[model samples]
Target: MPFTFEPLPIAVAALTFLLAGFVKGVIGLGLPTVAMGLLGAVMEPAQAASLLIVPSLVTNVWQLATGPRFGVLARRLWLMMVGVVVGTLAGTGFMQGGHAEQAATALGVALVAYAVLGLTAIRFAVPPRAEWWLGPVIGVVTGLVTAATGVFVIPAVPYLGALGLTKDELIQALGLSFTVSTVALAAALAGGGTFEAGTAGASALALAPALIGMTMGGWVRGRVSEQMFRRCFFLGLLALGAHLASRTLI
Candidate 1:
């Protein structure tokens, strides 16, 4: 933590969080996704995840708390949240395993799937009646994926999109979900003995840059075309994902 890293890695983290935060600010998500994709390339998945916790948790909490419907959403989404926690706990040991290439490949596949979902702009409709069972199922799948790759946006994001929420509710729901996922991940990491104080410290310091980038991104959201921005962002993810996967396989 505390800038103890070599200048190169320190600078890399500062810039990476800054960029990742900006993307989240603009689009209302993607901080962890971007952070994991980029950082996982340079370090172990567990280490990258450790670096992700503070920044992602802080931002998502802010996102969750700022909403007016927090209590109502909590009541509604509790089942899904419970499932995420359970699934994450169930996946305790997979991420910290000794298989570097396997982890990298898993991360890559997650990225590609996420990128495709974003780029395709595919939308599914979930009737309000279905949330009780469907929500938990989706959460468990998302949690299992998160346990493997340290990314929680797969079926979760898609499932959320299908819920037919108003714009504000959707945003708040994302915050709550991501916040839960982050906490679950922290628990999983701790349980697996992969959590590190240094990584947490460095990730904490990353908060400043992430915040600054978010502010700037919020400002940009009004001026930039979000559709075009999303296309570009997902395209970048796709390329990065392919490289990570192919690099390991080859």
Candidate 2:
């Protein structure tokens, strides 16, 4: 492992994943989003994304398996997952191939859009009749974005929410979708040659603090007012996104 960094950056990475995992433990999502946005400051988007794969994949798998309706949701969402794979592979190297600045700008834009949607709390519905077609479309778009920015919750999360699943089921469904996205992104990164042994080791080491944070967050979830927390979260994301966008565009 020849990667070099001062102790400050290492501390930042630890704190970033800890915080990111805590957020996920509380809200059931946002681990990759938080990690990517914060880590982007100290590393390339591709490298940041590489560091995210292990923690996100392991946590989401746990989320997916803990649910009661795995078979049903798996059957329902397989089409969308396939689309995700296709989109990710098709868009390989878009972010890693000398497009770092554009990728950062795009990452900032993603964070901004997601924050605005969260703050507004707008909701949409998808008729049962439309899921067959719409789901895959959303998955493809999500996968393309994941390929670029390492965030996959955009259209996919909203669409899953619209499916009218119970709370537990929705969380599990998200886990399923995100697991697919993580694996696809790994394949894409590997294909691009950015997912090397040292990078893989870095991602593996991040899992510990992430798990610790998730544990702490699970304890806090029962005590905290999630609404207030979410408001603050989105506001912070808005500011972070704006900072990234401004810093890059300036």
Candidate 3:
């Protein structure tokens, strides 16, 4: 309710955005993963998701608009988009009920499972059996996490990567995924009582950091080695998930 752009909050916002963007830039994903927890400490979970949405959109748009694989990304486009839209809506709707800590605990657990899967090289697929249904399942998980903790980029990335898609397809899939998620979140907020004008404005303010982070991340993308960055990213996820889970039990 208060509008005091105090120096600390501002700085924190900028750092969070910058760090998130950097992660995305280097690995082609994980901005939300990097920033969600930090943002949660300073702002409500819903507000944090709203704030990052614009910046995330901008970053993805840039990739889709200027990258070299738009045409390739066009094929199979509808399916992935639809999935993200559904999942994001489901996730956000769950958050509307105000389950911050529980969501965090659940998300941390899921991330730990996913990370372990990633490490163990487990193979899960949408099943020749109606991937359409599978899409929303991913969407709901992502959307809930996005609403709860501001990090919905996890499952989508690994799923896409596993398909052995090219770089363009990967980027484009993420772009579409975020787009659908963003729209769904807005609609969900409108339906719920949490959609406030001031909070939206604050979210907009936070977008700057996200954009800046993406910009910096883009530059870093070329320079950073993927193998190293990924190793670090997974390790970071493990650490963060462990911390989150520990907090829940303690």
Candidate 4:
């Protein structure tokens, strides 16, 4: 199909990307998660996911490069990456099916769960010996979730947080994981026939606003109390999730 741009959705996509990017700049994550949440409210879940592909890939690549020990981290995470790819491919059928709304609802619930987790001060640790088994498991789960809803959080972020990585390493690891997931997701969407030139164009257009918002957010991060900002951010996510879930249910 040829690309057709609608003024309203384009505006929504631009604004949502900017907001999502701002959140990511301040917090170091939540670009896709926040974008999908807000976009799902207005667009088809698959379309929202499609819109996320370009910006997510580009920013995360930048993130991955700016971090420490890329090769070492990649080597350590190889199995997990493999699992993420395979699982995403396997799960793409859900997004292509008639149950796309269900996927959106699931995304809403996932967002709520993520927000709640963020609000809490819970800490989970993974032992060095356990990474071999846990890594692939978390990867597959994250990939499956991404395939369904275009948001990759849940077990993946938490599991990575459990590993005793330094702050920079954690950020880099997350970027690596998200980058791979974005690529896998784009492939899946293309194969499923849900992403085409039209959506790709919109996704590309959205990149400008997202990058601008990210730059602004980075600047704000230095001025504000991170802890306070995080609290407000999670609270907003909680509300957004509830709203999306309600729409799906009601």
Q: Cα-based RMSD of the predictions, in order?
A: 3.3, 3.0, 3.4, 2.7
Poorest 10 consecutive residues by lDDT, candidate 2 = 1-10
**lDDT per residue (tens digit) for residues 1-250 in model 2:** 2234568667878999999888777667778878877887787788888988999999899878888899999999899999999888888977766665676566567768877886885855799888889989988988887887787776787688678787568768989999999999999998888888888888888899898887776666546565665565566566656755665655
Task: Go through the candidates in order and give each one's C-alpha lDDT.
Answer: 0.77, 0.80, 0.63, 0.79
TM-scores of the candidates in the order shown: 0.83, 0.85, 0.78, 0.86
Scored by lDDT, model 1 comes in at 0.77
Clashes of each: 0, 0, 4, 0
Best by TM-score: 4
lDDT of 3: 0.63
Instruction: Pick the winner on lDDT between candidates 2 and 3.
Output: 2
Model 3 lDDT tens row, 165-245: 645455566666666666766676656645567666765776776777677867765565656555654555666566555
lDDT of 1 by residue, 45-103 (tens): 77888888899899889878876799988998899999998888888777766764576
Clashing pairs in 4: none
Error of 3 at 200 (Å): 3.3
Q: What's the alpha carbon RMSD for model 1?
A: 3.3
Model 2 CA lDDT for position 48: 87
Q: Indicate whether candidate 1 or candidate 4 has the larger TM-score.
A: 4
Q: Candidate 4 on 1-250: residue-level lDDT in tens?
A: 3234778777888899999888777656789877876786677778888889999999888778888789999999888998899889989877657776676677678768877887899756888888898899889988887887787765677677678676567768888999999999999999988789888988899899989988887677657665665576567567656755666665
TM-score of 3: 0.78
Decreasing TM-score order of the candidates: 4, 2, 1, 3
